[model samples]
Every structure is written in C-alpha cells, then in structure tokens.
Target: MLTVDEHGLTVSAPWRSSERRIVGVIRDAEDWVLKKLDVWNAFPARKQTWTQDDRIRYLGRDLSLELTQDTIASLATLRDGDRLQISLADPTHTDSVKAAVVKWYRRHALANFIDRIGALAPRLEVPVPRLFLSSARTRWGSCNARREVRLNWRLIQAAQPTIDYVVVHELAHLLEMNHSRRFWKIVASVAPHYREACAELNRMGLYYMDI
Candidate 1:
C-alpha cells in the first residue's frame, strides 16, 4: 500500500517483497504519486505562533484567537461564535497559550466523537465501540480487533459531516475489517455522501498538519 501525508510518500509491502517489485509498482503509479506530492508542496507548512488575533480552525470555520492574562487559572473558551479566547497566567508565553488551546480541542473532540460513534454505531447494528483521542500525524482514525477506535484530535477542526463519515468508516470495521467492496457498501449505507466527505477530509489533513 502507498500512503501520502505531510512527510511525503510511504510504501508498505509484504516482508518478502523485492525492491524491484516495489520500484515497479511506484513506477506504474508515478503520475498519481507526483500529483499527491505536488498538492502537499503547494500548501505552506502551518506553524502556530500562539499570538493574539491568530486564526484557528474549528469546525470548518476560522476563529481568531483572543489572548488574556488571568492569575487565577489558565483556560480556553469560544466566544461570540468566532473567537477562541485563551486565558492564562502568562498570556505572552507561547507554550502556555498553545497548551491551553490544545487542551480545549481535546476535551471537545472526545465529547463530539463519542456522540458521533454512539449515534452511527446503531445504524450498522453494532454496539458503540470504545473511542480514544490520537495525535497521529498521518492517519485520521484507526480501529483494532478489540473493538476500540482511536481518532485524531485534529478532526475537531473539520465539519460535522466530515467527522460523521470518519465515525461511520471506523465503526464499519466492526463488520468488515478491510476496505473491500462490502466494507464500502456498509459505509455508504450510513453515509451516502461519504465520497465528498472523504475528499474534504483529505484537504483538511494538510491544512491541519502543523496545528
């Protein structure tokens, strides 16, 4: 299998697969590989400065960061529907500001993902699997044989439909473990527009890379 993320291309093959065979595969898919690499290269690397008025992405919208100092406690909150207000003992400290904002994202991500899983799992006639937050850079979500699902916390920055598609995709694994036709059929049953959602999520993947 070949995967592309912010880092570039990765090829996964059987242990005994020969280097020549791998090179042949990549050669056959050269155009596709190059296109994906070009897309990543087109987007400038994202680096959060944690400064006031900085733009933060949440739920497909850009919210400006509002910084303030509070000697009592450090906290982050959404205000006026378009601002993420982060209050800290030292608001000028970049690390503290970033930490507070990330904490808020994780907290909200857990609640949101749990709700999605709970609602979607039953549609597939499966019990809601255990959900956990992940910080992985290359993948959005994963499921294991133990019926546990781990989703990237950065998904909180995506729209609700996109999030639901991922939830259904992972929950479908309970019935079909691989990306076979049956598995995709199961996904489509619950999320008819999953193809569009998949494309949107891919775009967001690069956008959320550094954040």
Candidate 2:
C-alpha cells in the first residue's frame, strides 16, 4: 500500500487483500511520502527470536523488514559451515544498538546480488529482471513476465549459496517461464547442485522466521 502526502491520503496497492490489516498515516511535510504499510512495520515483530545485525527488522506482525545499515560483515555463528554474517549491523554486539541487522542486510543484499547478477547475466546469456529491494514479509523473490523482479530484502540473513540459488533460479526464468523440466535443466546447468542448495535454503528458514 502507498501513503501519499501530497494528496493527503493513503493509496492502497490493488494487489493487497482488503481484509489485511493495513494502515496509512499521512501527515503534512515538505515532500510527498508513499510508504508501504507492510514495509513500514517490519521491525520489533521478529526482533526477539533472531539475532541479526542492523541490517533488517520486521515491524508489526508480518510487516516488511527494515534495512538500517549498508556494509556487510561476517558473523561468528555458523549455520552448517556458512557464516551467519549480515552486511547491515551487529544487533547483539555494537555501539549502534538496535533491532536485528537483518533489515538493512535484506535491502542491501539484493542490491548487491543484483549487481553481481548483472556481471553474471551476460556470461550465461540469461535475461535479467529489473529487481527492486523491498521489505516483503512472505516472499524472498518474485518475477513477472514483464521482466520486473521484486525480491524481499530479508534474504541477507540467509546463507550465501541460498542467495545464489534464488538469483540463479530467477535468472533461469528468462529462458523457461515456469518450473518445467527445461527450467531445472537450465538451472542445473549453471548450478550443478541446485537441489541440495534448495534444501539448505529451506533448512535455513527456521533460523530466521518467528514462531
């Protein structure tokens, strides 16, 4: 949903369900503001369970995760040999104490990966979708036939291979529109062990989600 300040009202995203608890507060300001209801509340909700840096934080309930910092750093914890490092901030250990760093990492991670994909795109002759960072609560990545991609920024909390799998999977769509045999073939061609990588992503989900 979008909250417009210039018009002094809230504009909801047509795709959102009316039953969903979405609120918009528009106050007078110099510039126009259009904030998504979900994105605005992506903090505190998921703060208690996960230990993220200043990267991203889910606000109210299932809201969008906020990304507060930029630079990525390696964490000490290991989720199956992969270091749980967030490029956002050190939530548990830092002078800038705040909610989980997953928020910032979520936003920046996609931006970083998209750039990496740009380099990798030409190499594999794959079509790259125009991705924008968002604080979506449910999904990690989404694609449209129009070549537009919207990915959840919270993915920064995930493992590196998992991140690659998502990007590669999306890119593979440029060849195959759906999850068909040809799609798996293309994905496997580039990422030989994609099946294992996919399983790792699912396992990693437990560490990040709220109960």
Candidate 3:
C-alpha cells in the first residue's frame, strides 16, 4: 500500500515483494503521487514563533495574536472577532503563550463539537454520543461501539463545513460502522457536500498537525 501525508509518500509492501515491483508500482501511480505532493508543497509555512502580532487560525479565519502581561493568571480571549488576546505572567514567553492559546482552543473545541454533534445527531436518528477531545496527529474524528466520539481538538481550526463533515461521518458510523456504500450514503444524506469537505480536510490536515 502507498500513503501520503505531511512527510510525503511512503510505500508499505509485503516482505516478499521485490524492490523492482515496488518501483513499477510507484511508476504506475506517479501522477497521483505528484499531485498529493503538490498539495503539501503549496501550503504556506507554519508559524515558527508564537509571538506578538502572530496570526492563528480559528474556525477557518485568521486571528492576530495580541500578548499582554497579567501577573495573576494566563488567559486567552477572542476580541472583535479577529484578534486573540492572550495574557500571561510572562507575555514574552513563547511556550506560555502557546499553552494558553492551546488551552483556550481545547476549551472551545469541546463546546463547539458538542453543539455540532447535538445538532446533527437527531438528523441521523442517533442519540448524541459522549464527546471527547483528541490530540491525535492523523485522525480527525472517531466513533466507537460504545457510542463515544472523540474529535481532534485541532480541527477547531478548520472551517465549519469541514468540521461538520467529520461530525456527520462519525454519526453515520453509529448506524453503519463500516465505510461501505450504505455508510457513505448516510453521510451524504446529511452532508451532501462531504466529498468537497473531505478533500479540503486532506489538503489541510498537515497544516493543522503543525499546531
């Protein structure tokens, strides 16, 4: 099997598979591999420094970071719908700033995910699952036999439509656990544009992992 991610392409083959056969397989899929690579290459560089005036993605929009010293507690807040004001004892400390911002993201992610799940679950005729935040680097969301749902907190950075696609996907799994045609049809019933959202999520997955 061949897979592509932020780190680029990887090939997993049986131990008995010859190197020549692997090469041939890669050659056969050259166009697809290059297209996937191009998607990653076209992404803008991720932020390296968490400092004042830095931009952070929130719900598909860019919010500028505004740092302030608070001596008492580290706090992060959204202001004017475009600025993220973060206050910490040491405003200049990048790690502290990042932590505060991440804390804020996780807190809001839970609320947002819960709301989406609640809103979409009834449409799918499933009870709202117990929601949890995930720090996973690869998966966006998952649903288990116990009806529990875990969504990557970083996905809070994606657009609402993309977020909805993941929610609908997991909820659909409550009815059809496998990715068979029936499962996809269930997802399509609620999120008709899921294919577009899935493509967008794939292209942006690596960028989200950088956070």
Candidate 4:
C-alpha cells in the first residue's frame, strides 16, 4: 500500500522483494510519485490549532480543550461535557499541547482496556492473562498462545461498543488460537452483534489512526 499523509508518502513494499528491487521500482515511478506528492501537498488538512478553533473527537464525540494550571505537570483529563481539560507546566507551548493530548489518550486507553477486559473476561469464561497497549500500524488487537492480549491504544477514540467488540474478539483467541468457526462462536457468545461491529470496523479503515 502507498499512503500519503502529513508524514509524507509511505511505500509498503512486499517483504519478499529485495531492497534493490523496491528501489528500482521507485526509480521507475519517480515522476509519477512526485506528481502525486504535489497533489497531496495541495490537500488541506484539518486545523487542530490550540486556540479558539481547535477540536478533536473522543469516543465519537467532538470536544475542545481547556488549558488549566495544576500542581502536577503535563496532564490532560477528560472532564464533563465537551471539554478535555489539560494541566501542564507549559500549556502555552504548542508541543506541550500535543503531548498533553496524547497523554490523555494513553491514560484513557489504558483505563478503557482495563474496564472492558475486566467486564468481559468473566462473562466470556476466559482468563485475562495480561493486557498491553500497542501503536501497531496494521492490527487492532492480538492474542498470543500465552494469552497475553495487546490492544491498539488508538481504540480509545472509538465508541464503547466498538471497543467491546475488539475486546471480545481478542479474548476469544484465548479459547481458540486460530480463527476457526469455534473462535468466532466464542466472540459471538460475548458480543452478539459482532458481525455488525466487524463490518463497521472494516468500514472505518484507519479511523483510529487519528492523533
């Protein structure tokens, strides 16, 4: 896959292909790639300015940030209503704003993961071996043979139902290591509307990739 974003173009070359082979392909398509880059650079991105016009989404809800001072440094917490308030040592700094926002997401993502797993594991009759957060590019959740579950931290931006679906899906792997009929059956037992959730998840490709 070729993806162009704020980080510039990314080429996901085939693994089996040699570096030399990929470089040859890039050389052949250099002009086309440059043209695409010109077009991509012209595209407008959403302005997430920290002042009056900034807003972001959490759990499918739009919210603005409110900067505040606190005894502790560099913290952002989701408060009631449409404001995600942050308390940082230097709230005026643009870098601090971004860091605080990410901190908030990581904090809540962990909380959400713990909550969902705590609630669903017992109901699914599976032991919650361990939980970890991942910033993996291509996977939402995973379960190893050892039963440790790792969920994408970006999932905190998705709705609770969607998060539950992923939680149930990975937990099912503890019961069935492979994606056999029995594995999906276990997922369905916990999340009855898993098909819809799966379809919705597929439809929202890279939605959780937002910062």
Q: Each candidate's TM vs. the true structure?
A: 0.87, 0.52, 0.82, 0.71
Writing each residue's lDDT as its tens digit, candidate 3 over 102-190 gives: 99999989999999999999999999899989998767888799999989999999999989999999899899976668988999999
Writing each residue's lDDT as its tens digit, candidate 1 over 59-104 gives: 8889999999899999888999899998888989998888888899
Q: Which predicted model would earn the best TM-score? A: 1
Against the true structure, candidate 1 reaches a TM-score of: 0.87
lDDT of 2 at 51: 37
RMSD of each: 2.9, 13.3, 4.4, 7.1
- lDDT tens digits, residue span 182-202, model 4: 877888888998877655555
**TM-score leaderboard ranking:** 1, 3, 4, 2
TM-score of 3: 0.82
Task: Output the better candidate (2/3) by lDDT.
Answer: 3
TM-score of 4: 0.71
* Model 3: residues with Cα > 4 Å off, grouped in runs: 1-45
